[model samples]
Target chain A: MRNKWTKVLMSAMSASLLLTGASSAAMAKAKAAPQPVVLKVLYMSQQGYSTAVLNKMGAEFHKEHPNVTIEFTYLPYPQLHSAILTSAAAPVAQYDVVLSDLIWTGEFAAKGYTVALNNYIRQYIKNPKGIPQSVWNGLSVGGKVMAMPFLANFQNFYYNKKMLAEAGFKSGPKTMAQWLHQMQVLKAKHIVQYPYEDSWLQAEGLVCDYVRTAGEFGNGNLFNAKGQPIMNQGAALKALEWMRMLYKDGLANPNSLAADEPTAANAFASGQAAFNTNWTFVTGIMNNKSESKIVGQGVVSGFPVAPGTNRATLSASISGFQGLAIAANTPASLKPWAWKWIQFATSPAVQAQHLHSEWPIWSSVATSPQEKHLNPWYKVYQQNLNAVYNRPAVSNYLTVSSIIQQYVHEAIGGTIPVKTAANDMVQQIESLPK
Target chain B: MTSMPVESPPKRATLRHRLFRTLSGEYFWLYLLLLPSLLILVAVILIPMLFAFQMSLGNTSIVVLGGRGTISNQWVGLQNYLSLLQNPSFWQALRETLYFWVVSIFIEVTVGIGMAVLMNQSFFGRRIFRVIVFIPWAIPTVVNAMLWGMIFDGDNFGALNDLLLQWHVIQSPIVWLNPSALFPQIPWLSNALSYLGSNLAMNSIIVGDEWKTLPIVAILVLAGLQTIPHEYYEAARVEGASAWRQFRQITLPLIAPVLTVVLILRTMQLMRAFTLIFTLEQFGLPVLSIQAYQQAFSFGSFGMGSAVSFLIGLIALVIAYFYIKRLYREEL
Candidate 1:
């Protein structure tokens, strides 16, 4: 009886050990698969500031994802246009990701180089609340989304608080006439320092600003509502005339024609100009003691409204989260990994942390009171984001923008008459392949 | 074979043995000396050249192919070439190129000779001036272009406008970049005499290029000056020759070869004058290289681009050939 009991007990013990081993194996199978990824990113950070923020983010990202390595490359602001296009065209996946000015989405997307993130967006981010819907508009074409917005950038008028006050105004001019009256008042009073200054050079920034303002005044689309050319209309010519008046009256700095985006920002912060139009990042840059002469002295507001228009037109530029696109040709195996990394990087928690360092595309991150409380600048940025107008998302957008810039520059310089410049745009756009 | 060569077992070895031995040695030595270099040259240059040539000839882009009018679908033969030939823009670019080259070369060659001659003379600051003259060349082309661009900026921020106003040369500032301003855009190379022409004048004006590129010519002239013995100068001076006379006679004659060398080099390189023109475009001067670049890279019309490129090469060769026939006739 003792030997029989001993054999039975031994069998029971062995069975228990074998059962434990089987259960452990099942648990291991249920655990998540380790997705190995090397995410390569290409972006431009303002030489010092953005780079610092990116480095900090990289460290955090690495800590969170020890298996995934990050490769980041920075380009100068001016060359971003050429660099992004060339990289996208090259055979090697020069960068697994890309960041650029907003206008590039149409060109990059149409080329089918950007990876479609629609499935990923629906799956990973069900309700990215704080980001603007306008951000999504730039990423989609013909029902397919080519990229995801990394951040928000909407145009705002940057005015010198002190200069405006001295010019007998407490805040920015609400309307175009009011602004022109202010310029005249300042000029007559000799309170004007740099004249009625705004950068209207032949570039996307100026063209967008002008187009938006014209749209504000009910000038049909700068390219017409049907996406056909109509820039030769009266409203556009009037706008051109108004700009010319600034130069003609010597109200604007003579160097205004050659100035690019940052140069305009520099001029405004230096108190060399009374008012200028710019975007949200100006707040962070101007607040720095070393860079600005008017720290805490500049105020952000909506751009001046056109006469007879109920609202001011708002335009978007890329200074923050640019749309993320994955190449169509990327391997199916890499697709899931790419989607996951994009989801993680653009997550609300991550975006909120990196807020204003890059423009946040997540509505939740952009509008979070928590975010506004920290930066304060996002309040103005978010307001502008609410009314943002993106450029026509078409493949030939780059060609179109170049044409506009050239014609605009010619008109402003008086080299080509305003009417002629406007007409030229119509002719050129019509001549281009539909 | 052994029996045929066995004539008292020749110390130097039979002809067959010698030929085989030499062939084997040559194989190792030749390959050892040239293999790596050949491999690298093929990898870097020859292959790329062949690829580019094939692309230029084919109907389709090797890299980015697709579309009804794509590289392959459209059997447009040299229709792309024919179109480029007829393009007004192409002609405009060619015209601008000629204007840029002729003006830049004229100023650079003349000023370079002057500087070289002066450097050859005894002076207090000769070394300093020579070094200073070389400074622009030492600086990158973009930097040099920037420096000159700064000088011509008609805007208040321009150093040139400031200087001119300070000297009371003008009461009001000029719009060197604007074609419409009363201070009309200066055509520095063609229409303007360098002084009246504004910064745009550099496209027409020699200053845009003359000072920037003069160093290359100066160095070449200096080499020629060195080769001409001091005896020639001594003889001219002994005859109580005027400075101008000596310059025309001994100096010009001996320096002609170096002058031709610099001239040939400049002609070859003149087709690719993008840095200065590209820089100036920021201020709004459209030159040929930039226009062509825009057509190709910006517009993505590889056929038109290749045609433009081929034309540029053709013109440069023609110019070079003319110079070669005139100056390098006997020696070459």
Candidate 2:
């Protein structure tokens, strides 16, 4: 009887200690459960204002989610493409999120470096702060978000208001006919050295502009509506010929041969050239006291339309963002944290803050009319952004770009005729990988 | 059969021989003295070369790969090389590169020699002219490229067109950058050559690169010129040998060795040329080095770019091989 009583006492004592330990373990679990994860994001930058986007995005993202850490690596424009390819596509991807052009989605997705973010994207929709539907989702190879549009950089026309008025136009040219007439008037008065310059350096930039103005002027889709290659068409020919005619008319500057974006920007900024076509970043440069000659007087224009095409003005993006994707092999534990980060980055709060500066703010929903005049011609940039259509979102876009740059550069340099260059580019694009 | 009157030093002969051997020895004090510079060269050049060679063997992504570095990557054996064969742009770039190499080296050499000859002569303000000539070469390549790019802009507002039009030779300024618009007038630099005829591509290249390296050639030829005694020239003059004849026979042959060395050096520099080509090529022309760069970085194909780089190095090697042969022949 004495032994049984002692045993019962011992069992009660053991049960009580076990209960205490379970309760303590539960308390620790509650404390340690969902610690925020740090993420590393990388993107390329041009020589100019593109870098400003990265900075603004970083600060704004951190503000919304202080628990998550973010890091950014920026490179020069010429080197940015190569740098991204060499690093992220490698076996050990150094970045969690990469900022790239929408065209690169095909290559990255095809190679399986980027993950489909569809599963986690569902979580973002339920959040109190809604994730704006990405503009670049349709560009992805799969229905998944392969890369998100980090910024919206599109080609915009920069014209001198004074020069346009002096050419006998009350305002900027509305149609291609008036644009050509204005060039003639400018040349006659010797009021402008080069009446207009679009930086046709044979990179993707010039090609996008040509297609935009041409598409507005044409009967149908260029290359093809479905991202196929077909440049030897009449629409494409007319676009090339128009620029040629501009050169022949003695209205365009002969010195445009030497001017790429910087020189052209400098020419327009120095008040030497009456009109210049560049991206959204030129406004920041024009606003600067040391670099710009045209401050408040610079007027931005959508690209001029062809004579019969009722298109008001056609604007296009040389390169723009696609949906961003996480790595497939990212630690499962880090997924929820990374999605939260993606959500934070795409939030309107972040977009509004980033767009307030000189960077190309990609979020259409977040751009404010009040914040439209951040630089000398911010309003014009705003106008261009609304109409900006990304370059062909295809897998083999880069290969096509390489071949096209060679032919386009040659054609622009006047070695090959429009018909020949067009035909060669078509052949080259056909030969390019799809 | 006896060694023909071999002259031996009477004193300090053993000491001198020992010193010479010690200086040349692998682990000697002199070798130790050269260790730092050798270490620096290896660190800066050789190691990177090895890394680059390894990278060429891999399927490295140039875009989204991050900032030009990733320590370890997956290897794609020979895919890059195969891709290059398929790439039409590669062949086009190669053709352009060859043209640039041939044209640039030709111009840089001929004008370089001419400049050297001028500098060797007695002239007022020659020092200033020599310095002024070197200014273009002394400037960094990035700046040089940007400067020339500004001049080549296709707009009628371009500096080159303005200068040409102001000269009143043409009715209107031409689009130098545009390949579509047929230029009414020939701007000497933009004209294409029909291979082998007096190529003017040589002259355009001389505009940028010749200034820096010509002085080097001039100074080298000047060194060789000093070795040709004035007595020979005076004697020739006394014997009624014309100045042209003297230059053709004595000066030309005697200085030929050094000129050969200079030519080899210039060819090496010009063959691997990139900066000016990279900057200006965007305006419409590309050199061999520029082609190599675009292949590797622009297309994100490491293997192909590496192959092109190696090809360029190979072209340089051919020149070096000829030089080696010449050196061996000279020694003989």
Candidate 3:
């Protein structure tokens, strides 16, 4: 009787072990299967670029992962940053994927609003090498990638080809003096009312123009290694003085002081200005027949260097790249899907298709022969991207940029002399808490 | 008297019973009627003011949809205010604010009064003229600013520049919005006008704001003008009073109340002028409102911004106090 009881107990133990193992296997399979997810993407509302292209990419992403649905919220550039911050501060995550300005990387990372993308890149991204190291660096903070750089833009020199040719120039100016001479010729010949127009309004646009112009004269960096203001240096002063001269000499459009990017672009596209300096997107705008009176008449060239300086030393233009990142508040379950969307949006195929309007951050997409064939301006854009100047990556970049904007605007407005403005800027920046 | 006091000594009302009685009495409905508005005032105005005051006392640096969005209260009591006191930008903004307030209020009152007097006359198109005068006030302030921005645009395509060029008003197109261009160096009055001229950006903004607000002021003044009996004017006319004398003696005194109210209200509006100037010139002309906004939003210095805002509020309060005292004296 004792032997029979022992055998029965052994049989019961074996049955219980089998039951537990089977249940564990079923649970693992359930967890591995893709669950339904809805992701919200925040992006700028740029015409034909952000809204259209992002929606297309979302649809494609939906096709790949049928369980996932994408909901996009398009905001104006001025409102996008504020909206993202508001959503991040909410108790629950509002956005899964965010399209962020390069200037915002440090601030966002410091606030813990963005998750580190390095692990995702290593695990999910098949061709991380397709993105340039410089771009990756721009999107990274403290050895961790904060976002995936997708759109690359920089300031480029744009001029009316007809006006230049009419002024007896086969190519655009290569030096500051040559550029000034061409402006004079354009003014003298009545090819345009003003030699050039710019988005010099006392805003972020002014900072962009200032940095690009200063890079041609200065060390191509606004701050020193210690994060102290170096804009009062000789080269930067010369750049400010040059801009003042443009205003004083009636070479720059009088309205340029009040004009934002749209106004400047409109003035150029309306054939009211012979030359304009703007981002890469303006090239597509100027070339489009529907929106441009100067269609097929505009040409893109590298930003002019100082009179005798080599291109290597003074060829820098301000980079205005926008990238995508997963929100820090995003649930762990939703992170994989968010990263998947980012990858799909920034993939080579989509980038090549929108190459004419939206600049590519990927080296492969940027240099793709098919893309080059589709958009003739790709070569010039790539050339401009080669020597891009990034703004300071400090967490307080917005504040720093505002200070630069104020002093530089006062200088341009003649409220104070350029020297005084530069001194004031340095003093104010020095007074900022370390 | 002793016997009556003995009977009257029946217990005085309890505190709770008296409070309940007051609440349930004739004033109860009146209090109920005011409860919603009182709640709104506390929620919208009082709460925010208290919160801002609290923020001002701390080293709060919250830049709402940008920056770090973290609130750090290091308890730097009065440091922000002291720092602002020593800062040149703060003084400059204050100076600009005073200049804007004085100039905009003066122009608005003058134009508003002139329009009011003219519209008071029984003319053939008086109704049509009144409608025309109020059109500017009907337009949104931002829309008005944008419209004026386009008109005063410094480009050759600007309507004003184009018209002036066509009329040969000057040799070349003048940069209407350029602060430096507005005031050329005059040998005699350079010292006085130079500073003012360098701030033409502020003046241009003032022009835009006045265009939007003048109509409202005129309408208010006109309503006050209508309240005055024509018999007073008739009596003065029979007594051989000149139009100027009649206006100085009767019209001015009678309309002083309306004008005082207008001054107080307009002063408050101009003291906190942000949207029009922000939309027009941005930080081109730094007034207190713009300075506060820049401190809070652009620089993320919430404590400093709150201090700046309180300073502006204090100034407005002091000015309003004087105006109200003057109004009360006039009423007496």
C-alpha lDDT score of every prediction, in listed order = 0.66, 0.63, 0.81
True contacts kept of each: 0.05, 0.41, 0.32
TM-score of each: 0.83, 0.75, 0.88
Q: Which candidate comes out best when scored by lDDT?
A: 3
Candidate 3, backbone clash total: 0
Which digits, one per residue and each the tens of the lDDT, describe model 3 over residues A1-434?
A: 99999999999999999999999999999899988889998888985466777788888889999989999999877667666765665545678889888888888777677888888789878888777666777788788888888777677889898888988988888778888999988888887768899988888889888877887764557788887788888667878988988887878987788888888988899898888989877887898898899998899888788865535534567788788988877777788888888888877877777775677778887778877787677777766787677777888788888898888877986768999999989888887776
Could you list the iRMS of every candidate?
5.7, 6.1, 4.4
Q: Model 2 over residues B121-199: C-alpha lDDT tens digits?
A: 8999988986776676567778876675556555445577668878887666544433332222654532433222122
Rank the candidate models, highest lDDT first: 3, 1, 2
How well is each residue in A1-434 modelled by candidate 2, as lDDT tens digits?
Answer: 99999999999999999999999999999797656667766656564334666666667667877766777777655665565565554555566666666666776666555666656655554452232233544345657567544455556777788887877778877667877788788878888766776666656656565665555455323467666666677666776667666755655554554345676677788787777777666667676787887787787776566665534335433334434456544455665666666666666566566554435344344345645544445555555555555455566667677666666555654567878988988876776655
Model 3 C-alpha lDDT versus the unseen true structure: 0.81
Give a tens-digit lDDT track for model 3, residues B1-332.
Answer: 46554443335556667888888998899999999999999999999999889888788753323312345556888988898899877887887788889998889778888989999999899999899988998898878888988888877678888899889886676556654534346644544544442356777778888888999999999999999999999999999999999989999889989999999999999999998888777777678998898787656567888999999999999998988887787664
Question: Of models 1 and 3, which has the larger DockQ?
Answer: 3
